[model samples]
Target chain A: MTLRANNIEHFYGSEHILHNISLEIMPKKITAIIGESGSGKTTLLAILSSLLKPTRGTIYYDDILLSNIKNIDLFRKKNIGFVFQFHYLIDYLTLKENIALGALKESDNIEELIKTLGISNLANRYGNEVSGGERQRAAIARALVNSPSFVFADEPTGNLDTKNAIGVFELFRNFKDTSFIVATHDKKIIDYADIIIEMEDGYVKNISSQRT
Target chain B: MITPLKALRKNKFKTALIFFSMVVAISAIFLISAISNGIVGMYSTMLKTDGDIIVTQRGIADTFFSDINYTIKKRIEKISNVKEVNALILGAAPVDNLPIVGIYGVSENRFDSYKLISGIYPKSNEVIMGQKIYKMLNSPKKIVISKKEFNVSGVFKSKIGFEDGGVVMRLDDGSKIFHKSTSIFLVSLKDIESKNTITDINHLNSDIEAKTTDNFIDNYNQFKIIKTSSDVISALAFLMGVLGIVSMMSMVVNDRKVEFGIMRSVGLPSKTIIIKLVAETIIIAIFAYIFALALSYIVLEIIQNTQKFQGYINGEITFSLGALIFFTSVLMAIVGTLLPAIWASRVDPMSLILRGAY
Candidate 1:
């Protein structure tokens, strides 16, 4: 079932940050959220992921309303994954442990994922010892390891150089069966989207569909 | 659950600071507790070392100076629960021009409890000295007194505190030397329940003070031992514990602010974030506890061996089994981490993205 947010509103103290945001995220499709700075794009994504609750709206996963679920952690673990710009891997753990940490249940085949990501040689090294590209890749690997229905990336390649940014975007593109809502201002990231959503001043300004 | 050991390994300096503070806190607690235990133990041993009930002269104001009628020794034996009674005399005597020797007189048969490590119990006019006193005398072969030379019996060990600095002799010898009736009656109770018998005796002998073993020991402890050291040390330890938790948690919260923000952004609930923060503190506390225990053991061992503190300080090495300290440390860490964890969770996702903290 697809994830849907209806007329979501968010606030910061007495200040309203997001207004009347509605969106539906289908499974196995790429949906890119593009916006200028302070456009509430990240807030909308956060609300969809259920990280932040909308003050005056309803969110539903399939027909089961998310706001009614008592166990948000279980829902998030089962249905959602997240990647951030800085790739906040625990510096003490090896790459494998960092990736496996995202999964609610343990898997014996983490080495397979490491091999798939071509990070087998770097698996034993600490997160601090790895390059920026490798760290970003590890974050992607962590997000995907949970096998959630959707993956949310908030400027996932924001900290990377042009080459690493392209590589990370390619990795996101390769996960075709996992819905993607990547928030970025990177033109390269925008060009690779199947559905482009442009946001400004806490509202959706433009949306366009493209042939994958 | 994340292994705090691995986390601590990543931040060695910070971990060391936290560990140091924990050690200080635990050690202070250990030291204070040990002293309290030690004082109580010393008094208990003093009472148990002699007899069940000690009858001292009333109105004398001090047990050391109180002189009881030696005939009361026979009268106490007739009391219910009294198994045997002995008269004892305590006095100070010069040893090699040093006034450090405490003299005690007892019946020859009652010397069974006195374990002689080097010499035998005194017979007739002979005297047995304590190990420390004997050593202080440079292992004299004989001592002359009152125009007579008495052969030294073997050196003996005593569990009583004053005996460590004195000599023990038979009552006849002590009477011959001091020319006075023994001052105290040491009465052995037939069983543990005989404490009630002593209460009855106190009722009967209105002019005398009859005390049970514990009461007698407690009185002696109040008079002889210094108090307040434990309270002072415990207070200091508690303060250091609070400081340690505050500093460690503050730094940890600051370092993990972004991580907490991201967790909040990704649909992790606030309650879950709070639980995670508390769990992380508990994890850190466990590490600190283990480290503190190990360090306390090592430090205590070194103090025990180097300072020869067996008699001076009661630093018994013991593992902390009580959850109070553990719970207290975790509570402090949680309290310390709460404000920052909440602050991080409350960060606006849009602002975080704009400021590039996420």
Candidate 2:
């Protein structure tokens, strides 16, 4: 059982944003939706992530439809996680507390996860005291805290410098068993995806699969 | 709760700005209400100091304008439990640069109620001025009332504001000048039938009201007017305070839209967002109420010391009024956050990213 989007169409007050989108998200794989600004890639990611409902379509999580879930927030809490371009960490909270904010339930693996992300020491500092790369790493830790089945990221490395941008993609590469649907304009993201979805002007221009 | 508190702590300047606004607005509300209550209180105390049951014409806004025919005093004097009925006339006139001077016209027998500090009791057209008023006039030998000249015979002292800064004259002389009215009758209640005295006097005439000195302000028409106006203004002041809080809290929520978007994306429920906003706003309101209470005391002090309100209105310091302010402040905080919370919780995470919030 996996996620599927069927006959998805979206409009912004008569301005079409997405067109007849149908796709299946593979389990335990990295999928990149890459396009230029205004290409509607982020909107598609929003629809897939439960942050939005398409104008004409149904999203299915395995055998259950998204609409039938009744409590979208509860469903999202149980199975989904998200990271945005800017690491909107609450500045007053320490990085560790910020990560703990996303926990669906208490888990003993948090310390190990922080170590894996290479931010174990940085976790105790306030969010404002940390460097950009450190804060983004904390954001990533926050997203994975729940051990969700799907992690949706919208331009996760958009605010980073060149070195830190590469580091973010490397972090995604290390999480092979977690399904990631990342939307971005960065060409560097191409190397890390098991499947690449190319969007152009509210349409999917191409979808390519590469095991390598 | 910790998250909300931490958020407020981090935005120190903004939180302080919110607190200051609430304090000022709530203080204004407290002042208006207190002054109104105080004016009623001061007048009641002053009017009741030397009298037991006071009688005045019904529907008269001012005691000076209340007309109970001179002959009515005879009927009240005959009532059971009535020891003495003093005919007192109250009026105001301008003297020199001073705009308002209180004038009391009392019969010869009631002269003892006012202590004569110097000289003799007023004779015929002569008048005695209050020590405070005498000093302000630089010891004038004569004062004018209703454009009539009268000699100032002596200086007197009184605790009541009406008499402390006023003139006292013979009842006959006052009637000749003020004309066409008898202001009030002060009834001295005998111990045994004091309760029935007021009821007996009120039954004599439908045009006049008779109440114990303690309940005089409650029945006075002028006091009713003051009370009604203060209620309206206080309500408006509180509304403005609530609106101020709403505007400030809404802007705070707007500034955190990016953070709220992220919280929503991470599957934080709308309920949690509401709780945070409620917690933060209520905390601010509580602090504001405390500050406003202190500020109100200072404001009342300044008003009391000022020449304009010095003798008349002293702000009523009551536990019930303080409690009223506290409850209203909490209500203001809750109502102020309601809209912002809903808006924050419903924020579109995708729209925020596209709009450059994240």
Candidate 3:
């Protein structure tokens, strides 16, 4: 539940993406990782969420280091979920089936989840057939289907208007037991997050806490 | 696995192309291999006769062209363990417009192998036409060989391709027409287990060679060449099949790298992804192979019915041959899917997202 990164640095070829970055994400709390374009927010999110291994340093879920866990995919399958800026749903799959892909068991309540995401009428529709806002909501539903402890979102609202963007953030707040790490450039996230980690040029410039 | 099938169904065009490629590859392999198997089967059936050993003159490329004194049969009969000696005169003579009709001349008692369908065995100066050749030539009352006319006394059928496609006559008539002492001497041993009799008979004359029918069929230069060619051709066809699958699967996986990346990000294990791809390939491969089998059967039926291939082959795919084809096809399918799955698994998951659909 508590996610920790220690001196995580990454590079793509000769270019450095993230400097020595370290942070702790509290359990059941909303954490926002904010930075300008090309500031390495997505890269850091990628490393922490097990999408990519860091070039240097470590990430830990509670006390267990990432390298110590043998099957990373299975580990992620059970405890972690991911949502991307593009609402990366398989175009060939129906909306309900796409969400069910993340479900680890038959008892994950797919119908209720679809209703919660307010995509019940579009459950049988192909991923490509839904509106952008509805697709993002379905994406969020997918990330929560397995009741994973942590859900990582990278620019989930980049293409959305103010109302849709707010709707997306509201879903994150409503999912009570699931911790969310959102990497974005949106200023609106600051009002909803319990912790704010602002990044500049791949370095963690500031870490602030705000709770209602 | 079900999701992958759904995906294939969704992209029906791509799936169909892969399916067609697989079908063509498998069908080509089975059809060519069947021809190869047919040659061996034909020879084996032809040689299953009462005579256990064959004696022909040394240094001959064409077995029927070999010549030795017919009197050598008496000397060979006198050898220890030699039960009987039968002299045979063999040659090829053109009939009507058909070139190279095989001709067989045997001693009086050697006609048991022929199934007499319509008439008795041939007498001196007379000929019994093979059933197929008789019907094919429209049942002529007389035929010509070496400018000599012989009355067609009866019709007989022998499943052996060379015999069924030609004519049989008495040894005296054949010797006079062919102008040779004899082409071959077939020997039957008292005890078939007596292997030394062949060597002893071989030493009797310097100009002639004797070998057991099994040894001759296996070691004959021409038969060896056919076997080797069949093996090489079948192996090459299977290799090309594997390569075709590899190429098709490579394109499929390459095109879906982003999709795989998303799947991985959603926590689908690389092993599961691999299993799915292999499963999909096997389904297509099995279906294609079954379809190819049906196609091959239709082609074989046409060959069996056609005038060109009658008596040459039975147009059969044996049990072992079918199983060999099936296993090779499945192996090709698995190998083809595995390579691409491995490449997809190693691809950076987030890189696909950042660089692709994002």
Taken over the whole model, the C-alpha lDDT of each candidate is 0.71, 0.82, 0.83
Scored by lDDT, model 1 comes in at 0.71
lDDT digits (tens) for residues B234-298 of candidate 3? 77776777777788888888677777878888788888778878888888888888998899888
Better of 1 and 3 by TM-score: 3
- Candidate 2: misplaced stretches above 4 Å? A161-163, A173-177, B50-52, B58-61, B69-78, B83-86, B107-164, B167-177, B188-196, B203-208, B211-216, B356-358
Each prediction's DockQ against the real complex:
0.28, 0.63, 0.63
In the range B96-142, model 1's lDDT, one tens digit per residue, is 55644567777655787678898778888788876666666688877
Stretches of candidate 3 exceeding 4 Å from the true structure: A91-93, A105-112, A119-125, A128-134, A159-164, A186-190, B57-62, B65-69, B72-90, B116-120, B124-159, B173-179, B184-212, B305-314, B352-358
Error of 3 at A7 (Å): 3.1
Interface RMSD of each: 3.6, 1.5, 1.3
For model 3, the local distance difference test gives 0.83
CAPRI level of candidate 1: acceptable
Candidate ranking under DockQ, highest first, comes to 2, 3, 1
True contacts kept of 3: 0.62
